[model samples]
Target: MRERAVQRQDRLLSLVRRRGSARVTDLADQLGVSPVTVRRDVEALTGRGLLDRVHGSVSWPRRRDRPGGGRGPDAEDLVLGLLAPSATYYFADVIRGAHEAAAPAGARLVLRICDYRPAEDPARAAGLLAAGAEGLLVAPGWRGPGDQAAYSDWIAELPVPVVLLERSVPPGGPLAGLDRVCSDHTHGVLLALRHLTGQGHAAPLLVARADSPTALAVREGYAAALRALGVRGPRPVIGSVPADRDPEGFERAVQELRSAVSSGAATAALVHNDVDAIRMVQRLAELGVRVPRDLALVAYDDEVAALADTPLTAVAPPKREVGRQAARLLLERLRERAEGAGGGGTDRGMGGGAGVVPAAGAGSVPDADPAAEPAPRRHVTLLPTLRVRASCGAGAGTGGGATG
Candidate 1:
């Protein structure tokens, strides 16, 4: 059953790469299999990062080369596990980067949506881990104490290494030992603030979620930058608006902002993210206010914000680099495990075993071989850069332009 599944997956990948797109019915007919079988194959391959399905059409990832045409690893079932907080565009981009990094190492990437639930079953994630997942990548959802503890315990007990994305565990905590690849939110906010400052804006409002770490970091950075620039006045009227709440709630929040603006509490705003920023823009327009002329705006996460109608100016993080770093760490752990299983040379510096070397000679000889030494594990914290566009005071073709 496993071998047949593998063969079908390989053939499906070949078809997807050759044709650029494949339909389930066409794939089933070409492969001499039932439509149900083809659907399963497509689902499995999609989970494994071999293909992307959109509106009933399946296509190979644009960044990846055709199957059997590259020296990198094939898109195998190497996915150990995944944790998705929400199906937001930011999370999707992060997942895409992870898949790109893992696919080259013959690893599959399985996504599990947490959906802002209070708690998640560790056992639910265990099955994938047991099925040869070398590591786990977690994007935690709306967290409560119980949920946080449950996730921390799961990470502690899991045999494989783990990487946390866009979130942080408690400081001086055991879970902190695990690898982390996250956007530098402090720097991200600094970039946004600096852009606003350069545009001759002062006392710009900062809209944020009250208790979110991402929000807190952004607030801290904004405050610090303001203090450094010798600016002050009512602390920019910070608000705790829940973007994840109901659609009406967001509308209500915007109404409140409009009221505040009418009362002269704020002039310009720096939103926590593009979603909220764009929503705010739309709401202001509906309220008969002009953007940039009446109010300047900036946001975080460039991809989603840039796609907005006004093409938002935002701080962009090294998203793909974060994914690549996390995958590379997990792959190192996997290679260590493979070396241990095969009883190969233990000179890889993982410190898993005592190797076979003459006792006296072992003491006399240097253990570090330039070629045999493991590559240094990298802990990368990437700062965000400002992508100035038409959304802010800078018009299109201004000195500051969209970042790659």
Candidate 2:
């Protein structure tokens, strides 16, 4: 119900802005709502001074007298685009977070998902820029190895501020020139490894997608945590999931887990994400291996781990928080660029797209500053929480989970 109200309000705002002024009856008819509902919404916006309410008609505040007054930037004039690699599973939550953030942060949001294909993002970003998007929030570098240079380089060259969500340049990617927000995946993996060790599983295998930037960090964290736990000898098997999510590769990933288990390569294992973890769990069941009895499992990015039959213990990333932070960061950058208030730095690293639409009132802002000190770039790392449940056998005597 709250979501419905918010959507209605957004629609109302868009309509008023488009038409300059609208009658309450027309608004109600257009919005498929009652005149009373339109009046109430108009009343709310009028209180905020966003709408000039006269009798049954509504209109946006005039220039020099809008919400931000004469000089302040207005959010209504700006459009920020978001490009995500995946539309489902893990990335879906990030998009949800960004969507929830749009109204509060004050920018109009344009969202596009490329189905995990990084090759297509440049074109999408180009299109959004041409369509008048002023800034961008993107999840890039998730394709295969050869994509880093092209993907990161393209991001480096954009004409507007870019905030990366769930991604930052790893090695061979573009060097730092943008803001980043992502989970502290290394620490997340370390936590899972420590929990596995606590459960008496010393030689747990770590299964991960080798091509993933987040997975790479997790693998590093797993090793670092192992060192912390005083296990310095040969490390556990670091099994790699292939780059493709294609049917053949998907089957191969399941087969890889089965081989690892059957060959005794893993007494206990930490899988990188819930999707593969669920697949591994289901396969283990078919192989007659009951979870925690014969094998202990810990999954990362706990999006759907709990939905599995055994309800696996998994490390849950602060996914929504990452997106929220990224949105906030992007908005701040846009504001700074518009106001020329902060020391400015033009985007570096190579390609150019479209210019930002000029600002007015609160939405009025400048291009990049030429003389001021550059604003500090931000990188927020949020930690993941482990949700303990049945798969890790959480109970006194059966204690293999960290419920405390």
The most accurate candidate by lDDT is 2
Q: State how far residue 33 of model 1 sits from its true place (Å).
A: 26
**Model 2, which residues run further than 4 Å from truth?**
1-73, 170-174, 232-265, 343-371, 395-404
Instruction: Please write out the lDDT profile of model 2 over residues 1-404, one tens digit for every residue.
Output: 34355457657877877688899999999999999988888888677455688777988666423345323334454567788877777887888788777767556677766776777777777655643466788887366655666666677677777887877565323435457898888778777777777767765777777666667667778777777778653444455554345656656666666676677766678888787788777766887777877778888888888899888899888888887888777777766766654323333211231112233522123564435644666667888877877776662243554432
User: For each candidate, what TM-score against the reference?
Assistant: 0.67, 0.70
Q: Model 2 misses residue 163 by how many Å?
A: 0.9
lDDT of 1 by residue, 250-309 (tens): 777677667656777666678876778888888789897667767778877776887878
> Could you say which candidate leads in TM-score?
2
lDDT of 1 at 157: 57
Model 2 per-residue lDDT at 104: 71
Clashing residue pairs found in predicted model 1: 78-108, 79-108, 80-133
RMSD of 1: 10.4
